[model samples]
Target chain A: MSLRRLGPVAALARHAVLLASGALMLIPFVWMVSLSLKPPGEIFRAGFSLLPEQWYAVENYSRALTASPLPRYMLNGVLVCGAILSLQIAICAPAAYALAKLRFFGREGLFTLVLIGLLIPHEVLALPLFILAYKLGLLDTYAALIMPFAVSPFGIFLFRQFFKSIPDDIVHAARLDGLSELAIVWRVMLPMAMPAVIAFSIFSIVSHWNDLFWPLIAVRSEQLMPPPLGIMAFKNEEAGSDYGPLMACATLVVAPLVVAFLAAQRWFVEGLGGGVK
Target chain B: MTAGLTFNGINKSFGGAHVLRQVSLDVASGEFLSLLGPSGCGKSTLLRIIAGLERQDAGTVAIGGRRVDDLRPKQRDIAMVFQSYALYPHMSVADNIALPLRMRRLSGMQRLPLVGGLLPGSRTTQAGIAKEVTRTARALGIESLLARKPGQLSGGQRQRVAVGRAMVRNPAIFLMDEPLSNLDAKLRVQMRAEIKELHRRLGVTFIYVTHDQTEAMTMSDRVAVMAEGEILQVDAPQVIYADPANRKVAEFVGSPKINMLPARFGADLTHAAGTTFDVRARELAGTAGTLGIRPEALHLAEAPGTGIFTGRVRLLEHMGSDLFVHLDLPHDGEGGTLIARLLAERAPQIAFGQTLHLGVRTGRILVFAADGRRVQPDPAPAAVLRSYA
Candidate 1:
């Protein structure tokens, strides 16, 4: 129970390794914020300064906001991510419940096909998806941004795992009480699987929010650009010399995800771990 | 309320193998019926089918004289208590018990926390439901534990809440699938009596399933002995134990299962054990049959004589109330053993490897044909026929 029992040299070595790794992870985040707050002149200064000498937070933030349609981009990101998340919950939950509980033909085959989605990279589907979207006249619209991302094979598989862990007797008991299939999913399985749903929600929200490639390919309108695309545009316009406003915009882009994670830390960890199993 | 259940030609198949093959039985109204069998005997499956949790491939299920083959579980007016208790972990015992009522009586908007109270007559209906739940909980002696969750309660308390949930719905039939299987021995025994008493008090038809013969024999008004998805026999517990319809029933019904020694019968009604016993096979003459003698039916004899066989004591298992003696009979096949139960007082001080004489009660002997069916002699005793009836 005592550190001395583990031997001083070995314990010190372990502590040193842990501290070094911790600093390695923290340095980039610290630099991102510090550079965002620094004036343009001090950003690339030779001397190492963890904190900037002159704070240009307000100016950098205003520039970040006004330089591009950051507000509209944020709105679009929220709308698209929200739409995908809602669709995932609505579609994946019942599908998961069916896969876990229902008896039908080709169930295993269907599940295997859904799992095949996990094996295929999203990039591989970009060309075919782009063609399909253009043929359907869904390009330059939120439909293109939200449609393909909404159906998550990973979400279905995660919810299915969580749903399977629930005792079948509980579902049977609910059935005997006269609950419909939808009611059983919503009132019983869904509530019991709250941690998983919350966890998958975070995944779905973050993935769609940070997704740059799909949105870039599917959408051509500037008005429909999400936060990540907007940040790219802002970076391009103020590249080479202006790192302050770029960092500020990057910070803003990551802030919402960090806040969401902080709010749902417990459920996020539980869901992620539980879903994987 | 009394609701009798009838299953007609019930058949179930999984993939290729048939688990239940044309299983049929009738449970009388207000009667406690137990489906007793070994594991994988389809007792639980039959119970689930009755509860509408499982659909039979080919059959008609009727509860209280109405065919419910197409009706959903809730519409069938039947409630089931599962082996795991199946109490909703998230809900309080009160909420769990009241769930059936809430689902049946309350609307979607009426289940909400705030607006539910404002709905027309929702307040009175909710109060009535609560009152009924309280009454049911008090009846089950679980009223004090109602506010607590399932994890907070003891096994027995959770079981009572499960039963209370069934009671609040006032279902026409109660289907219990090994509900007491998860409890400790002492609690299982205690709950067995309580469940039987509850069945009597409620006067609802109860179809209870269990692999434990003792539970089936003690609590049921009538026991249906099943094996491999087929009911071997259905009769009152004492009758089922004393006069089983087949060899399987005779072996399954008793503790220290009936000792089945192969015997060959001559045309003269003389039964020979290992080619040399003087016992009579009467109705079973001229055929090879298995002679089933209950452990308690065989008494320790002093010398070989009529109705007696000589054997050496192989092992002894002493219970406080009885003694189980494994005897190595001369006729017993290569290293095979025959067991006998003796009352503690009458049990002799027998040691292993000691030769002994065993006497079987002729009247208590059971004869099974090659096909596993019980065969009775001509002019069957009135009591035997009466028991069967």
Candidate 2:
């Protein structure tokens, strides 16, 4: 074989390895969907087959849809996540611009504080935040849900890196053209940081929409509960694990995220890489 | 259309490092003044201070006899073209050019993305902005690139767009910070001429900052030679060349650079090559100064006498019009190579290692004190001294 012709073989081997790993990742998703469509008796049965012996897709989906307040949970999820993300961008972009470009006193020290914030886990703040929200009479309200997540240290750091990558001349040019500092942030920096915003948006939506811990502590009302808390309620109210409807709820809860990711997977991936540029 | 700029007692420092020190300059209305200096000489910082982009540690910047210290950069009535061009990457060329007009003319509510279009009179305002953008683009010969983003255009095209952006505002003062430094040499030369023509047509005050001596010398009405955070000399291009105020100014202005050799002015008044001239400074007697001569002032001589220096030829560089002869001089105290620019037609046959005599003309010799300030004789030397002296 010619040396030039060996290129295809190398490419073929690369694809084979990739395909194997991809399928490995897909197995759990396939099994979850398969299990959700099975009857309760079939879930515990040891058959290793991806397809259930009998189809209960319609029955399980109908119960998952009607037997609980799934729509309300999804609605609450959307509202809370949307508010959190909007506030994150509005608050973080200016902070990042200040951290990256402005030369105020203690600027470097403040940026160090932000970097240190990234190392801390949000779970560590859960207890104190819950107590504070309780003291402020904010528990069981959307304010408790959204207000705490408004300022994101990671978002600030990401945006600061992205902002730093832009040449200072571009920002100064905006100022020369009569833009105030806020106008420079929104009109110039935000538009240029859209990729990062989208990337961060997905991250924010995924993490917060799926969040159960904070909502569990903050909410006592069922209507205020997001998807994770709502799905847990389905388990307790249905009087057991009742694997079919529960898995169906899990499938429904995860489907929106998967679809969103698939819709903008390219931007999501590029958004992750955009900060370095 | 024009206003003179006066920079009085400008001082600046960054992190304890003094960048500009008591630098002062005066530029007449409609005059093109270039601040010429090496990098880190604070030329750009001075321009920024004038533009209000930087705040001086202590100074007063007045444009057209008006104090603008309380005003911001936008309120200063000055537009600056940056070295990077600094065009908005996301905005179309038309939008980039329209931005200054929009910011100055439109209210905050009229600039919103979707709702701004619904407001009454915004349509006509938008139309006006568009028309002005088109007119400016046409003036700059970039009408075809209006729809293109800055990233889509070439460097020269982007530069024209940047200039077009600055021109649309019709500001009284235009500041440019080495705007041509980013272009290739040929394009830089081409754009240099275009900018000069633009300055002529606009007739506005221009304070341009550049480190390239050729750019400053070829383009400005007055060139300020700066070093070590201060302006050493400010004069017309020809005047700056013919009569520099100090040794540093002379050394920085020319192409091959001015030549300097240590010499005694009171007793031994000629170059240190053992050649002699009738010394004439009664007050400068027994005082020491260095002899300065340009490369053009030195001519190939037949013998070593009367302001002549003899040295072996080190190298010969033949530019199309002139031959640069590098001579390694024999010395009493100072030692270095000397370059003499001789015309190609007048240059004698030359070779390496051949001893040559260089004669500096009488009036062309400039003497500087030990501190590098230009020093003149108290009594004028005989204007017509023969080589026989």
The candidate maximizing DockQ is 2
Model 1 chain B lDDT-worst window of ten: B380-389
lDDT tens digits by residue: candidate 1, B1-389: 66898999999987887879999888888889999999999999899888888899998999988999998889998889999988888789999999899998999889877999999989999999999999999899988988898888888899999999988888889989899988999999999999989997889999999999999999999999999989889999999988989999999999888888776766544454543443454657777877788888888888886567677888888898999999887744323467899888756668778988888756677778877888764433455643432
Clashing pairs in 2: none
TM-score of each: 0.90, 0.93
Clashing pairs in 1: none
TM-score of model 1 (first chain only)? 0.91
lDDT accuracy of residue A105 in candidate 1: 94
User: Distance (Å) between predicted and true CA of A146, model 1?
Assistant: 2.7
Tens digits of lDDT, candidate 1, A16-77: 99999999997898899999899988987889897878889999989989888999999999
Candidate 1 error regions (>4 Å): A1-25, A120-141, A217-224, A237-241, A275-277, B112-115, B272-279, B331-336, B347-353, B378-389
lDDT by residue (B98-146, candidate 2, tens digit) is 9999998888999998999999989999999999999988888999999
- Candidate 2 wrong stretches, greater than 4 Å: A1-24, A233-240, A274-277, B277-284, B331-334, B346-348, B378-381, B386-389
